[model samples]
Target: MRNKPPYALSSVDHALHLAALLQQEGPMRVTDAAERLGVAVSTAHRLLAMLVYRDFAEQGPDRRYRPGKVLRPAAASAAPVALLRELCLPELRTLMERTQESANLMVPAGAEVRFIATAESPQVLRGGDRVGRSLPAHCVSGGKTILAALPPTELDALYSEDDSVDLPRLRRELALVRERGFAINDQLTETGLTAVGMAIKDAGGSPVAALSLALPTARFDRERLPGWVGALSSAVAKVEAALSAR
Candidate 1:
């Protein structure tokens, strides 16, 4: 029988145990994680956040933790996630430079969107890098932009399985997003954050990901939104062109 080491770090042990639970037992809520690990809710949340940052876990639309890329079985082909991040970094940087706000590259993962790369603004009061973070598809600018591109039936089917969002409200917002060819999040995910996003489509005319610019809510100017969206759209176009070339 394997014995626990006397010097085993409890925090590391807890994180590993949590990862094991996600991999073997599937998705679990933070409360369930806390109960299983015998830790406080805040402690469990911190552990899960660390796992998410390391790609050992991801939070879904239902806000349950699940095994991430690092824990999942190997894919048949080269993982596109890495390639997308690499190819989009330059564009993200350009967008950040143009808008003076943080730029991010995200891809839809089921009913959630995962932040894979970020280029942070140099301003002292700017939005920070959000790489490795995940949020519900209906809650963030990039997620909404990606979702707005979905086929009507597919979009309806996706939210039908999850009851956390207001279907009618999301539908209305997505309709506006489609009309404008971009999406905006005004303190939707975090209280002080605002973001604008546009979809990046492949040569086949299918959206593969989204590019967004996030700023502090205090700095958001509706008067300047058109300029910001224009810059974001240009960056997306460049990224899409590169993807097509590849």
Candidate 2:
């Protein structure tokens, strides 16, 4: 075994030890984590939050940190992201077929949204497939949907972590999203693409993912935008239902 270096970061060491503890001992409380790592409760909370954000660990209903997909035995549990991608693909496919537009599944990754799955429109000229693309959360319709669901404290933390954002403007935008029950991108991320997005909540009603449909800007119409939004809403509900069943 390697010995600890003189300049090693204690925070990193604590996080690594906490990960090992979760794998061996199952779900754990903040107090337990703090005691195990010889750290403060606040530090343990922050470490666990980082793990949760990265899909390394998940917070249970009881506020305990469970052995996340990253620590699960390969033969015992399938990766949660992979399972979500598998379950969401059918819904994305259906959305693409029904709307004849590109559909995508996105999950937040800190300040950005990662596109995990996609179904391209069958049209010759349509949004191309983006199975592994990432974009700023504040700039995309799907990302906005996820951001709109973040609580005030979480939002504040996100803004604090990234100083480039205009907090007041983003607050206004997220408020609009909550009121509208979805988000719309009017060529915000790209010049010729307009997209509508809705959040996919988990059993606990947390916005764990988002669904979006991307259509060409030329084809966009204010009169028909509601219809597209309705389509996305229905698709999101279907995805939520599937997740609930799982």
Candidate 3:
């Protein structure tokens, strides 16, 4: 049999392919997608711009593309976290009211996590982390929680071969998170702070984000950790159920 050139896909087909790729692969830059798709830079940009304009994808602060709120309905029609923010807001607000600690919704973005939404507690001493801030995937509880939900192969691809703390360690920690059903970080990103996280899944049982509570280490004791974990777990479950119902 003679070898054949790769089949040339149409622009529409390419656009759809790009959307699916972004959805599966998480956030990526246009240049990276262009290189992977073997398309011209201009072609890739055009496709990405169209997706962004239609809200099928969102452009992050780092200029990478991720599945947008519009894609959520098709991806998992139940709960629609993007749309349910309104519903979640009340619960999140209540959480803040009770705990007086910062709460946030974190979505995975390649090797990083992006804060999609946040609620600040009214404590007089409270300072805030920006809503759109991006943090290293290995350093945050939310990042680890989402990472734990990925398959072993995907986890391996995320980390190094040696299983060292560099990349492999991240995979290993994620494995631990899967075992534990939650993740905790003690000042990994900053001093004197801690965070507890639980993964928020869609109706399809895919982890789309993490819900976390952040507090000061001085005030957050081992005795209180379970309560914090329970609160986060309850909130995540509520969000997951809401998504599933929708």
Clashes of each: 0, 0, 3
How good is model 1 by TM-score? 0.72
Error of 3 at 193 (Å): 1.6
Rank order by TM-score, top first?
A: 1, 2, 3
Model 3, range 1-246, lDDT digits (tens) per residue? 855437855887778888898888999999988997889999999999988766668899999999875555421212244665654666677666767888887777666677767788677555265365667667898888887887777666756544445765566777788988999888998788788888887776677788788877777778887887878877877877877777
- The 10 consecutive residues of candidate 1 with the worst lDDT sum are 72-81
| lDDT per residue (tens digit) for residues 102-140 in model 1 | 999888777778788999999999887777666777888
The models' CA-based lDDT, in order, is 0.86, 0.83, 0.75
User: Which segments of model 1 are wrong by more than 4 Å?
Assistant: 1-79
Model 2 per-residue lDDT tens digits across residues 1-246: 988899998888888888888888989999999998888999999999977765567899998889775565432211257767888888899889888999999887776787888899999878777665667789999889888998989889878767789999999999999999999888988899999899888888778888899988988788987887888888888878888898
lDDT of 1 at 146: 84
Highest TM-score model number: 1
Give the clashing residue pairs of candidate 3, or none: 78-243, 78-246, 79-243
Which model scores highest in lDDT? 1
